[model samples]
Target: MSEKLKVGITIGDVNGIGLEVIIKTLANNRILDFFTPIVYGNTKVASFHRKAIGITDFSFNVINSADQASEKRPNMINCWHEDVKIMLGESNSIGGKYAFLSLEKATDDLIQGKIDVLITAPINKHNIQQDEFNFPGHTEYIQSKTGSKDALMFMISEELKIGVVTGHIPVKEIAENITKETILAKLRLMHNSLKNDFWVQKPKIAVLGLNPHAGDNGLIGSEDQDIVIPAIEEANEMDVFAFGPYPADGFFASDNYKNFDGVLAMYHDQGLIPFKQLAFHNGVNFTAGLPVIRTSPDHGTGYDIAGKNIASEQSFKEAIFAAVHIAKRRKEQDDLLANPLKIRKLTKDRD
Candidate 1:
């Protein structure tokens, strides 16, 4: 049997449902069969969450570092040894402080090749802002850390895959940000990600317009006609099978998204609103165009029900699964590339 992949998980916020979901997701021993789970956070914090959730049987094997992670057990690396105050269901600076610590520690290891993939739990964007950790979210942070010039906020699910041109930016700034170069860059990222990361043979990507009804052909706005349309043409000229500056409303309403392998939205909510509405519980946020593989649950910290034991771990679990699958596929592709003649011979034999 092949060796199991090592998955490094970061505790988002001690107060939020991050720990709760992490514990719940790792409770099942069956998951250990595919990946060795290494959690970067305080074990005491994890214990607090495990007990609060009324999970009496589940416990983590506390270790000093990722090198000691066990394949058959859920292992935790304490990011800090100092005692932390548990403030469940609250967003505060303390929560943000520790969230950053956990993320930094795990990500440092990820950069050093200590872990195969990283699955981050939900973190409150507002509270998690600091001098060193100043970015829109995890996607931007990871991008900067890994020196990736372009990264796509790709949302993946069983049904549809969506990418956004503008992520975590204000609505008013979105218009100014949607340029031909930017749109074309995002299209390129989405197209390549579909082909490389997701293994779509011939990815047909659907692009959405910035203005409502796709600018009504310049009646509503000219960005779609002037900028977006030309960018789509450029992508096609470059041999990317991309189509449409489709009206966001009608495109999703008529089930048009189902016809394409991927959808490219002008902004965040344009894609996520419909995606979350459809696959809220199963959607996985994948950071594409990065040297490292990272995935996170689609939902945020359930602050309202942090300690109520009501938070579902389905999305978090799916994020872990997605990270594992993508990492394995990437390795398989790499192995195939190492033996070009074998790949070509396999292709010829198939034909």
Candidate 2:
């Protein structure tokens, strides 16, 4: 508790509004109370943004590594060069290359334990893809880097958090791809994340049906009655609170989701649609089951309004806070596991 948590952040797509939101969020002095943020990006672009916004009090120090950064002042840990000197709203291949490099730097620092957590801004998916780098998004990139196969992507707000059984795959392919091993792994990952990252002692999870009306008990489809039901049975034996194959069309009809800690969507849009419907303004995209804490804003690069400065910093700020909160919980849990008696005294009386 004596030292501040070092949060390494990636400023994505300098041509987009990533820098704008990062500047706006960290400028608030209250953030210093929670984290010592080390921003991984270009120094020149950050300086240009500082001048454009007419802010003089904020200054960024360049560092080669996270340890070089001091908690006393916010730092811009320079990782790459600004590819092009382009306007804010314009798109360029140079900008994409720079953005990808910043993420690579941050990922390296994270793996080395030089930083406690990773918070990323939005990146242009199309612009950043090159012949050498062919990732669909940040989740896949992190998964490949960490060599983790059981990772799940969850979009979170205070009110709702939805994890995807399948993400970024074609809609037509989802049905064929849904399998028991995949569903079981997703459930276990979500359960462990809630317990370890969120400090939920007994996490409850809901599973959504792949077909309408839960396949009407196999009239419409047999996946819910066969695959999903068997998975839930296996989960029950493990003592994980998992229930469903709930009807996709009617799962959110009432307050059905409120009773569970997290929900597993059949596919991407099935879960994201409701989550964004409720918490788009301040939602966070969290990568569950990573060896380290990772989070980002739930939105994407707004190339249309990249320069207007109207991009809401709310989700970015929320992502930063979520990363901090999860990191703190993970630290606390680790400390408790290292010393069981301390945790017992701290939590035992909650009956």
Q: Report the number of the highest-lDDT candidate.
A: 1
Per-candidate TM equals: 0.98, 0.95
Q: Residue by residue across 1-351, what tens digits does model 1's lDDT show?
A: 135888999999899999998999999999888899999999888888988989999888999888898888999998999999989988999999999999999999999899989999988899999998999999999999999899999999999899999999999999999999998888888888887888987899999989999999899999999999999999999988889989999999999999999999999999999999989889999999888999999999899999999998999999999999988888878888999987898789979
Per-residue alpha-carbon lDDT of model 2 for 97-162, expressed as tens digits?
Answer: 888888999998888888988998888888889865688789988888888876899988889888
The C-alpha local distance difference test score for the whole of candidate 1 amounts to: 0.92
Q: Which run of 10 residues does model 1 get worst, by summed lDDT?
A: 1-10
Clashing pairs in model 2?
A: none
Each candidate's lDDT (Cα)?
A: 0.92, 0.86
Alpha-carbon shift of residue 232 in model 2 (angstroms):
1.3
True-vs-predicted CA distance for residue 142, candidate 2, Å: 0.9
Residue-level error in angstroms, candidate 1, position 91: 0.7
Clashes of 2: 0
How much is the lDDT of residue 27 in candidate 1?
Answer: 92
Model 1 TM-score?
0.98
Instruction: Give the clash count for each candidate.
Output: 0, 0
